[model samples]
Target: MTSARPLPQYLVSRFHGWKATTYAESSAWYRRLVDEGQRPRAMVISCCDSRVHVSSLFGADSGEFFIHRNIANLVPPHAPDGLQHGTSAAIEFAVTALKVAHLVVMGHTSCGGVAGCHAMCSGHAPQMEEQTSYVGRWMDILRPGYDRVKDLPEDQQIAALEQQAVIVSLENLMSFPFVAEAVERGTLALHGLVQDIANGSLLQLEPSGRFVEI
Candidate 1:
């Protein structure tokens, strides 16, 4: 791990036709999901990393989570002013149109994305001004979450911060008019969780540091 090396970028490039091949592989099951109108019960907000995959982690196939991912698993407040927001669009579809019974913002341990947010808050990360990368903008949504938990010890910092970010993201979700209406009408349930990837532990917060295992 001393010398960092990029992943085999072409490994995925070799699978360009895998999407089409998948349809042919499970044509019947996919058609069943599509024809069922994709009324998924839960929507998962997860990281964009191929390894930290939501589908494999949740044991779900296609159409399980009306999924959204970014540098980190962040849910920006549905604030769109001449900006194309993919996360907001996914939330709109899942909460309103799909009527997903639950919206879960799942954060995990040792995430590079969450680590980036932590670094930014600690002044270890470079300034984001004039940055053209999409990640910088996405990380902005998580800055407050970092501030919210920056006082904790390093061992507990990321888990605490990421867990709190899940809560913040859930709150941000409600900022969307559709999400607010849905939650107020009791059409959607908002949940937040931090995944302990090391031990497969799923800990939930109780408005305080008290973590009750679920």
Candidate 2:
């Protein structure tokens, strides 16, 4: 069997620093969390971009949010084929088991995944069209989103597609029975947001299907 390598020195050092400072200051709070278990009120679906810090963005402490990160912050339509579906599994747990009050799909500007989807759909990224490309297949979920913004000027497409990622995920999330039932029962609410990385500004999707800066 292949053995895992030792942890990176930089990460190890950071862990030690956190333990001595942040963890030490909050040790009792941490213990209470471990004993009580997490009961976060919101489930956040966010991009896997390194710059998109979900906790920092929301001023969330540990155990404050149930977060799920993906390449494009996507939630595919419900498929009960018994295959592995990590995002769906997380959603199911958050909605059913955790009973989170809110589910938020947050996308961001300059998302590589959205950019790739635009490129692939625009016929500029032939490699992403190959069947064997996992990223290509995953980004296919955003093809419908691409079609929505394809006619816009080239400079505006990527930004619009980024917001569409959040919209698409929110739409797909409703395809899950548990999520839909919760929403119908008034036990769950869904929100969609897009963040601008450069200025740390947020845009929220309103009931009218338009994004307004907040």
- Which candidate leads in TM-score? 2
- TM-score of candidate 1 relative to the true fold: 0.81
Among the numbered candidates, top lDDT falls to 2
Q: Residue-wise lDDT of candidate 2 within 1-214, one digit each (tens)?
A: 7698989999999999999999999999999999999999999999999999999998999998999999999999999999999999999999999999999999999999999999999999999999999999999999999999999998999999999999999899999999999999999999999999999899999999999999
Could you give candidate 1's per-residue lDDT for residues 1-214 as a string of tens digits? 4898756868666565666687679889888986777878899888776667778777887877788887678888867797888888888888778889998888777788777778776887676522784566678888888887878888788877777677778779879998888889997888777777888887776666565778
Clashes of each: 0, 0
Rate residue 108 of model 2 by lDDT.
93
Q: What CA root-mean-square deviation does each model show from the true structure?
A: 5.8, 0.9
Worst 10 residues of 1 by lDDT: 127-136
| Candidate 2: residue pairs that collide | none
